[model samples]
Target: MSDLLERLRGRGWRLTSQRRVVAEVLDGDHVHLTADEVHSRAVERLPEISRATVYNTLGELVCLGEVLEVATDGRAKRYDPNAHRPHQHLVCSGCGAIRDVHPQGDPLAGLPQGERFGFVLSGAEITYRGLCPECADRG
Candidate 1:
């Protein structure tokens, strides 16, 4: 069973066949898939699964704080299942691939007191953009 399935079961979330397939499709490291991508994969597992079902399941997962919605390119929002862990993103400039990155120290520490402008800091998202080895090698 995937971590997502375990979490969902622990929370008593109803796991229909369609929902289970959707969750299964999303299980993996550095997995950031858009709704369409998830739907496509879910359909492969369960031929009758509907796109709306996948979208709804994704929305519910996001609402439950079990998944993170990432808007990396301003085109489509990708769903990330690693919501419990604190991390940033490393995006490939050429291929748009995203990887989870854990940098040392507090990210907020980099912002001086005056720079805060009086708002409380909850978290920060720092995305490092560069070409992956595959893209770099292609050049």
Candidate 2:
């Protein structure tokens, strides 16, 4: 946590109470939280924190490559804090639950050069959609 704070400070980010609370809420593995969820959790520690502040902090974290913004289903973007490694996502189509998953191979390797269309493709996102165990059992 101190490492993250130091990195943020080195990047010219102001270390405010609201930003600290938001960062604390986002520190963990497999954490995928929406801005509202982040605000709800941050309020538990700092009641004065505003939703806008949480959103702004999240945006800053994303810009710093400290977090990943996942936009699945064209709905609210979920913020993922597992930026230490490259991976993919597995989404529960029924309940909107998300989980980080490692694909069998390099996802980018599947993109052929012909599809590049003379454009340089730097990255790709692969999301596997299926019914989660709980949702599958319910159906």
Candidate 3:
């Protein structure tokens, strides 16, 4: 996480206290959190941080390529700190939980060239949906 901070600092990011707290909350594991979730967590560390600050920090991170914005569904978008890696997402239909996954094969190749409709494709995402183990066990 320090590496990320240093990179941002080298790029002229101010690294304010609120931004630092937001970064701390985002670090570690394959964290997929919404802005509200981030704000909720940030409040635990810096109770005075506002939702607007967290949102702006997250947006700056996204613009800097330090984070990935994932829309697994119609709900709030999720922030993924594992932006430097290539992976897909697995969603729990029952609980709305999200997981990062690396599936085998090139998903982009499956799309026929003729169907592209002239727009150049840069990347693709696949979202697999199903009931998680705990949710399935509840049946």
Candidate 4:
């Protein structure tokens, strides 16, 4: 992904081998990987890449808006690379699988006017939890 590298370079990020491996590991559709998971994948390509470097690169990506960190169960945050569009998450309560789902209506539309509490709200996060098909069939 030359374009991705160019964008990262434009942001004044150092283009190191470890960073490139980390970015490559994260590129793809519907990829939601934890930091440890990303480190594991990146290590396959660059055997000497450290977990700390992976974490740092991931944090930079999140700050750059190239990725989103999602913590569905208050555990280790998962990094989602689908930052090109606004959307929500659907997580399987059983197996911790995650998917993107579009709800029927604008989710923020239901926020009560009184609930504003004299504060300005910029955004909302909605996570729908349910059993994935495989997990549902297993039960």
RMSD to the true structure for each prediction, in A, is 1.3, 2.3, 2.1, 2.4
Residue 8 lDDT, candidate 2, scale 0-100:
64
> Which digits, one per residue and each the tens of the lDDT, describe model 4 over residues 1-139?
2245556677788778998888788777667889999999998899999988999899989998877888987777998877766688989999898887667776767798899887677777898899999999999
For residues 54-121, write the lDDT of model 1, one tens digit per residue.
Answer: 99999999999999999977758999998888899999989888999999999989899999999899
Instruction: Score each candidate by Cα lDDT.
Output: 0.90, 0.84, 0.86, 0.82
- Which pairs, if any, clash in model 4? none
Instruction: Give residue 2's error in model 2 in angstroms.
Output: 12
Question: For candidate 4, which ten residues in a row score worst on lDDT?
Answer: 1-10
Model 2 TM-score (2 dp): 0.87
**Clashing residue pairs in candidate 2, if any?**
none
- Scanning candidate 3 in windows of ten residues, the lowest lDDT window is 1-10
Candidate 2 achieves a global lDDT of: 0.84
Instruction: Quote each prediction's TM-score.
Output: 0.95, 0.87, 0.87, 0.86
Runs of candidate 2 exceeding 4 Å displacement: 1-12
